[model samples]
Target: LAQEGQFRQRSSSCHCVPTSLSMAVRGLKAVALAACALAVAGKVQLRHSSHKAADSSLHVGSFVTPLESKHQLRVCNAFANSAAMDVFRGAESLTAETPMPYKSCRDFDAPLKSGDKLEFRLGDASSGTFSVADLPNNDAVLLLVIHRHDSVSGAVSFESHVFAALESAQVAVIDTY
Candidate 1:
């Protein structure tokens, strides 16, 4: 009985749970942490989204046909600091923005057929994203892929806005055929 009375007295002096302000402060901290995490994820998602592109142009056939067996092709690659990727139709020429040459993935979105004898201009050195044409400074290397779909003469073909990207500490030609 004495011990119970003493314990009750001791606990009676401390008649406090967490204060409302303290709880509110903790809730604010939790919300801040959640926001930070979401911001980071959103940034990552944006970068990844850049790497992808949607089909904007219709493949009506090429304005010019491939007269020679080998078509002059080029692709604008930015695979070194940037990942240069584009989906093209009737691709006779490609240009590059960086010096790094990308490994060929015939159809980035889809698969390549037997008729698709796409040319890939690889870097003699650095196996990275490169383009053939260097706009201001000679930096990009272009991949010259051959794409020819036989149709009527008065036809036009081009890939839609089929491109997206993700900036990374390092981005390489992970997939190539």
Candidate 2:
């Protein structure tokens, strides 16, 4: 308790403390929280009043059920050669903004709405731009796999495979030639 008080006092009043890294980390956390809040707000707005009323019946401590109405996108990095892979969502780099990539696998997942075009980059190796409307409506989840391919012409390429369950659908194989 005494050590905790000292830490609080020093952090609150000490001007000589070098806390730039910690401050930056805190700022990034704030940004991420704000983004999450905005997403929740958007979902709330889209939901009907009947849904809201139905939600009130559930116990307070119970887990909220996830809505599967929106199309789900899962980007997987199956490329074994690269030490690490970076993923980008639009102009913002998803891997760069999130701290989870450093501790876990380099992958991204998001809810994509119909007619919304999602563009992403897989480091410098591969990139793709596709709309939710383009994907088959039969599958709820769209899997985008980043993989390596060695051509007979002594060329290395990154191919993206869209998978529905165990079946592979070759939608786009972008050549970085």
Candidate 3:
């Protein structure tokens, strides 16, 4: 009788070992499947958000100066009383009295000073120009110059979040194309 009882105990223990291994394998498979599902869901969410951002329009207010007109102004660096050409853009208006309406660079020959405030027009309106004096006052300025071939469907692209951060920190951005 005792031998029969011992044999029954050994048989039950052997059966339990296989059952526990099977349960562990099933648990591992379930965990793997859950991880895969989470990864797929994350990728889908990322794709959706990117598509939405690309389709959205970013409005940068009326501070950008779009150089679409024929009027041009060149910003030159005068070193040792000699001017080296730095940047050139379409000058809209310096003031109410002096409005730049020249068609070519040869026609407009006015020199620019360091602290000169030149008002330029972007799209269809006037925009402000930032200088060294504006920096001392902790004023933030966003300057965007769109080139002919550097636009998407005639619209200039920029990262709005980065500009927002700079605006929040009072750091002026002078973007030139």
Candidate 4:
């Protein structure tokens, strides 16, 4: 036969080229495990909708007492709200704080009066909106609203030690992220 049918058609096309490269490496590992299980179920549904919108926008007499020297504070980021606002001021005025580890706190519908001039919309869409006015009608502001599944290096190492201990007690740190 003509050279044994060309050696059985070149050994069945070299065994279908390693079985088509092992089915394209198992279809690229099943599309990378279904895109890592849909990115861990969209970060667990954005951490349960940012803990139910930070327990209904933190209201326990909306405490505010932390100002030692951020040069009499004023931070801005007022309007394209996805989540990420960390404005802390502390040098001495603290009546009883420490209860905000991150849970969507920026989409103010209305009702945060005290020379209200807050508007920060920056979660990450090429960040844009920002407006913060002179907020120091007797200092004591600590608004730390960060979302997107927080834990960004433990909220930037606890806001970089609360912005270097409120800039070494110069206290006016208006950070709008």
TM-score of each: 0.20, 0.34, 0.21, 0.17
Q: Write the per-residue lDDT of candidate 1 for residues 55-151, one digit (tens) a residue.
A: 4443332233333222222333323223334433335423333332343333232222223432323333212221222111111222222221223
How far in Å is the alpha carbon of 59 misplaced in model 2?
43
Best by TM-score: 2
> After TM-score superposition, what is the CA distance of residue 63 in candidate 1 from its true location, in Å?
46
How many times do residue backbones clash in model 3?
1
Looking at model 3, the pairs that clash are 66-122
Q: What are the per-residue Cα lDDT tens digits for candidate 4 across 70-158?
A: 32222223222334443322222111133112342322122233333322222322222112322333223333222222324222211
**Candidate 1 segments exceeding 4 Å error:** 1-18, 52-177
State each model's C-alpha RMSD to the native.
29.4, 20.2, 31.4, 28.4
Candidate 2 residue lDDT tens string, 27-102: 9989987987777666655553336564755322223444344435555554444345565545656667642222
Model 2 spans > 4 angstroms off: 1-68, 97-109, 113-133, 151-177
lDDT of each: 0.31, 0.44, 0.31, 0.32
TM-score of 2: 0.34
Answer with 1 or 2, whichever has the higher lDDT.
Answer: 2
